[model samples]
Target chain A: MQILDRFRDPETGRALLARVSALAEQAQEKLGRRVVFMEVCGTHTVAISKAGLRSLLDGKLELRSGPGCPVCVTDYGDIDAMVAFGRLPGVTVGTFGDMVRVPGSQTSLEQEKARGADIRVFYSPADAVKWAEANPDREMVFLGVGFETTAPAIALSVAQARALGLKNYSVFLANKVVPPALHALLVDPELRLDGFILPGHVSAIIGRRAYDFIAEEYGLPSVISGFETLDILDALYNLLRQVLAGEARVENGYTRVVKEAGNLRAQALLDQFFEITDVSWRGFGVIPGSGLQWKPEYRDFDARVRFAPEVAEPRIPKGCRCGDLLKGKLTPRECKLFATACTPTHPVGPCMVSTEGACAAFYQYERRSS
Target chain B: MPTGNKSEDVILLAHGDGGRLTHELVTGLFLRHFENRLLRELTDAAAFPVGEGRMAVTTDSFVIDPPFFPGGDIGKLAVCGTVNDLAVSGAEPRYLTVAFLIEEGFPLADLDRVVASMAQACQEAGVQVVAGDTKVVGRGHLDKIFINTTGVGLIRPDVDLGYHRLAPGDLILVNGNMGDHGMAVLAAREGFGFADQVVSDCVALHRITGRLLDELGRGVRLMRDLTRGGLATSAKEIAVSAGMDIWLSESEIPIGLAVQGAAEMLGVDPLYLANEGKFLAVVAPTEVEKALTLLRADELGREARIIGEVKAGGGNVFLKTALGGTKYLDLLAGAPLPRIC
Candidate 1:
């Protein structure tokens, strides 16, 4: 109660808002145009919507949601492959709840589950290990998904399964790293981003040094931010301050949780179990070194190696501008299929299904007056 | 021979065969707990006295997983659910008819405990169990136990509470903390060990509603029990039904500490979680203070507060967050599941 109450203090929150507004106005005047900043984490996107931070800013600055939601960015072909593995005999699919609703090339895990495929939602990767241990006769296939903050947990689960000699447990690794994806976005000539509000959780694991390239190469001011209202506002203020001062550098706004070097043990675990690979994304397509693949030593724990599921090439949903949305080229309302054809109940794209996806945030929090 | 031991205490198909076993269960277990004149007649149907005013009838089926929880069980939930339904409809619930579908091999002691809890809940609501029936299925055919209750109540002509009666500027009040029942059930099911156990807030709300009706007649415009879809869904339904909009303050909505913590850990929003004992009441702005005072004086309404107000608009529901931003509070799409991040 103390922590949540302090962060949610109305007076202090209002004061921060005023300060952020003043800074944003100064930056806009200095730049002679609207300054755009992107928060590159799905959790930050949800927090922003839940706290109504976007409306509070009200065009003083533009906040674009990037490819932070792992579920939203997972390739349809990979989802199809996982669903196929789940449907195989003697296999139990354990996944995060967000992935169950994401559509594959053929069907979603939820639809497959309704048809009697054994699919279970696990909160953590450790839960999947425990489940595999409990049911020794059946094979457990965990859909390991997320950014660096979650990659180590999956890596640890893999290590744990190997230590226990769990031959029947395997993971379909779709783990993504944030820095490479940010690099992919920065290189796009169409996207002219002024600054970035970095993901706190990922930064906590990979550290502020991971984002040094964005500042050194692209001269973009990047501030690592927490998910709370004040944390986000303070980070926005920092970004504005950097832009107004004509300075582009990495700043740690969430110093309480994130450090410069991050958790070394977690980075070590990631290095031990996974290697960089070219993985497909839902909207952004294939990006080199953006995904994590299981190391050869842990091949027995890789579902792709064990099942070798045959899936067709992924196809984007027609009229869905998720790719454009992820690149900050379009808002949710600008998309043609936003409210009419694509909704949370019947999501046509991964972005609409995931809670942190920009489309879902906009649909759930915005879209009232429209 | 009835043995007072645990070996032969489990239920069997013979208990539903209408033989001596069935009679023993009725007379020895149910009748003993629900001893009233109408049920004492032992007839196929119950005959009760009726009043002249129009009557309200409602029925609900309870198939809650894990029949027993910390604060209450499926039996108590069944009674309170029907009683609250009738209470919000501006009716005095009088008689209830309960039916049970029990699984074979279930412990008879557990059945007895559930029946006793149901009787106790009926007493608290000032209602009587006039009639009942039971059936037993083979093992694996059904969960441990399921309960269905049909309630009959009389509605006064002078009292009219409907969505049509709602108007703009009416203040919305909720009678206690939200999401306690839901979080408690989730924690108990998953065996999430917390220092402080979260118990379900399952209690009857008829007494508080009765007080509000008696004190401020016609001031209460609409009332609804926050159950499966929770307060957000209820508010959305009311808004659509009344052709108006409802605006709520996130800070004003009361959520218990344990509930909030559990919700956050599960990546679920408290607004969509279920509550058995809570209800949302819409009152005229003039009687907002009086309604709040009356609600606060009662044990069940101590945490009650005005969460929002109704406005003439696009028939939507919105929440003004603590950070001075507004967002739509949409109806729940499906079950609230735990997130990965």
Candidate 2:
């Protein structure tokens, strides 16, 4: 509570915002164009919208939401595979609640659940293990879908299941890495980004070292910032200062939580159980070494290997501009299906369904302004 | 499936057959608790006199997953839900008809306890249970017990309350803390085993509303019970209905410590959680102070605060964060799911 209260101090927050505004003005004047910073984490997207940060900045600074939401970025084929696993006989599909409504090519897990498929939402991966233990007769397959912040926990669950010698527990890994996706964005010719406000939570796990490539290779400023209002302002100030000074480096604005080297044990666990593979992103397409898969030794606990369900070809919804939104190519208001055909209740794309998705954040918070 | 004393024992299929066992169970359990002249006659229906005024009638069924919870049970929720619905409509709830759907093999002692709770709730609200019915279902067909209550209240012709009466610059006030009932119910169902058990804030709000109507009259523009969709949904409904904007201060909204902690752990926003006992009252700006004073004076309204204000132009609800930023408090999309990120 003390830490949380400190970040919310009004006097400090105003001071930080004033400094951010000043830097934004300087950066824009020096460059003779708007300074655009892309926040690659979904949590940051929600926080920026929730805090109304966009409205506070004085037109000099433009923030774009990247593919931060794991559920939103998951390929349609992966979702189809998950739904098929949920429908398997004596199989209980465990998933984080964000994945329930994400539309697959044919159907979603929520629809399958309503049709008598045994699908349960668990708060943590360990909960799925406990559920598997309790119902020994049924197979429990947890849909592990997240970034570095959540991947370690899922890896730990697999290790725990192995330690407990639980035969019925498995994981359908759609886990993604953040740094590689950032690299993909940097190489993309369409996006004209000046700097990056890195995801705080994912940085806490992967550390600042993982983001050095953004500064070293691309010569783009990057700042790992927290989700608090003042933290974001401070991060924006740092990014602008770097852009104005012609410096390209990764700076840590959320040092209180994120360490330089990150959580070593979590990384080790991830390395021990899983190997990097080429995973298809919803908007960005296939990125090599961006997805996590079970190692050969741990393949027994992989749902894809154990169940071997027939996965269909991935398909995006017609007229959905989610791919453009994810790459910072378009805003939610620019998309035709933003509020009309796609909504939170009846989402046409994964972006509208996930809370952290750019479309969802825009629809929920920025629609009126747009 | 009978247990304990034969005269007062477990519910069986015979109770629904309308035979000697049914009569005994009804007389022994319900009649004893809800003793009134109309119910004593035991007719097919109880006839009640209506005064010379407009009447408000509401019916609600309670089927909480866990029939019993920390602060209150299904019986208390059923009675309070109907009574609050009528109270918000500016009516004095007077009569209620109670019905029970009991699963076979349920303990008679539990049934008696539920009936006793209902009788006490009705007494507190100054309403009488004039008619009642009971039916028993087989195990696995239904949960332990379900209660349905129909409330009738008399409304004065001059009294009117709804979104039509609302205007720009009106104030939105909620009684006490939000999300306590929803968080409490979740805690009870999941058995999160927090250091301090979260008790549901499931109580009747008629006393507070009744007093407000008496003092403020037409100054109270709109009143709604924040039941199914907490404050966010209720605020959105008012905003959409009146075609205006509602700006709530995130810092001003009162949330209990336990509820906040539990909500944080569950990855759910407290604004979307359900509340049984809380209600949002939109009042004229001039009467805001007086309404707050009146609400604060009541036992149930101790922590009441003015959460937001209604404005013209935009048809959306926004929350001003504690950090001097604004966020939209949109209508909840689906079940409040725990976040994976």
Candidate 3:
């Protein structure tokens, strides 16, 4: 607790903020407009709003949230398939808490659960395996939804099931990788130019060198940051300093956990069971080699191969700007249905439903800032 | 065999059939702990005399998972929850009626412990359990047990606390830390492995509310027990009802180290978590110091502070962050969910 409290010290945060302001002022004058930077992690979006960092740098810099929340970017077709799995008799769908409320083409897992369907929330995929072992008659389908930080754990759960010879256990893989999505965003000619604040947890797995392309190919200053008030402030200070010095490079601000090469053991676990494939994003269309799926040897454990539930075509919720919001093209307030037609209670989009989504975090913490 | 000591018995469906087992359970377990003159009469109703003043009545049900946790249990939570509701209205809690809906096959030892806890809490609060009922359902029909408590109290003649009395410049103060009860219950239920460190603050708050009303009668504008919605929801509701904005200082609000750590790991906001023993009092600016001094002298209000103020605005609540930026506070849309990313 003392170690965590050290990172939240107000005095240290204030010192870093003063330096950020001085550097931000220099960068703004040089750019001839407010310097823009985007945080590409959902947790970073929430921390920035919770700490009021954006408003502190009000006129000197503009902060935008990108496509970082895994739940927000999950294609509607994927949700449709997962929800359909719950409709099958004698089948149980286990997933993280955020996935239950996300609306699919027809209904959500929460709705299906109320109609006598089996849907349970598990903190980890390994718990789902335990549940499957306890209830041998039920077919357990674990929805794998997350990025690099979570992929290794899900892969390990699959491995555990095989080692135990669990015939009733399978995984609905909806996992996406981050770097390819970043490459897709960079190629979009409609979006503007800016630096990036990378995800700390993801970088702890993929490592810092994985993002070298952002500096080498796109020439943007990006810093991998931890999720704390001071960490964010320090990241902003480093980002502004890079802009002021006219240098673009990938820097690791979260050196405590993230190394040059991430956890090799975890990467080896991921590589053991899965292969790269093209995945469809909710807002952005299909990007090449952006998702992970079961390899040939592990195909028998895939939920789609086991259940083969019929899924309808994906349908987008009308008037929802989650797509635009995910790409950092528009703010949540700019949407027509922001507070009037859509809110947290009756969210019309996944961006408002997910806790770490851009719209939900902004609405919860900083809706009154402007 | 109906042993004289039925403490080791498991409750059966016959326990609720108005048979010999029902009578024995009432006389042996409930009556022994909740002994009082009114309940001893064994009448159909509890009749008592009241003075020529207004009275308050409130009811709440407890179905919290695990039923028991560190610092308190569901039995204590039921009594304190209802007592605080009545106390916040400037009423002196006097009587309570408890009812139980228990699952068949529940252990009698566990039932006795729960009833004993309730009896002890009522004894400390100086209230009597004058009436009660018990029903046993089939196995799997209900979770282990559920408790419902209805409280009756007499309103203080001189106390006048209401939203109508609220105005700009009123100061808001809470009794102690936020999010302790919530994080404690969460740790116990989820086994996230910090149950020993964070204990629930499930104590009655009448002593603090009683002192505030007795001393600063007109100065106390409004009082609310922070329960299911915690401080943020209560403040937002008060703001809407009083037609004034509530501005809270993030740095001034007190939070325990264990609670902060648990919330960080779970990715939930402490402001929206539930509290069993915490309440907020809106006092006029003139009596801020006197009110704080009176509150700090009490054990429950030891960590009290002026966390926010009422302002003239369009009925909204805002929190000024530790970094000097403002954020709006609204009712939580849905229950806080743990994040995977």
CAPRI-style grade of the A/B interface in model 3:
medium
Query: Lowest summed lDDT over 10 consecutive residues: which window, candidate 3 chain A?
Result: A361-370
List clashing residue pairs in candidate 3: none
Per-residue C-alpha lDDT of model 1 across residues B125-160, encoded as one tens digit per residue:
999999999999998899989999999999877788
lDDT (C-alpha, whole model) for all candidates: 0.88, 0.87, 0.90
Name model 3 segments beyond 4 Å from true: B1-8
Q: Give the better candidate number (1 or 3) by lDDT.
A: 3
Candidate order by decreasing DockQ: 1, 3, 2
Question: What is the alpha-carbon lDDT for the whole of candidate 2?
Answer: 0.87
lDDT of 3 by residue, A92-185 (tens): 9999999888888778888899898899998899999999998999999999999988899899898899999999999999999999999999
Docking class of 1: medium
Model 1 has a DockQ score of: 0.63
How close is chain B to the truth by TM-score, in each candidate? 0.96, 0.95, 0.97
Question: Between prediction 2 and prediction 3, which has the larger TM-score?
Answer: 3
Tens-place lDDT digits, model 2, residues A1-370: 5577688787888888888888899888999998999988888887788778887784868998888889988988899999999879999999998999999988899999989999998878998999999899999999999998888889889889999999999999999998888888889898999999999888888898988999889999999998877888888988988998999999999999899999898889888988999999988889988999989999999998999998777666799888888888877878898889999888989888886788877777766632
Measured by DockQ, the strongest candidate is 1
- Cα deviation at A362, candidate 2, in Å, is 1.9
Q: How displaced is residue B76 in candidate 1, in Å?
A: 1.4
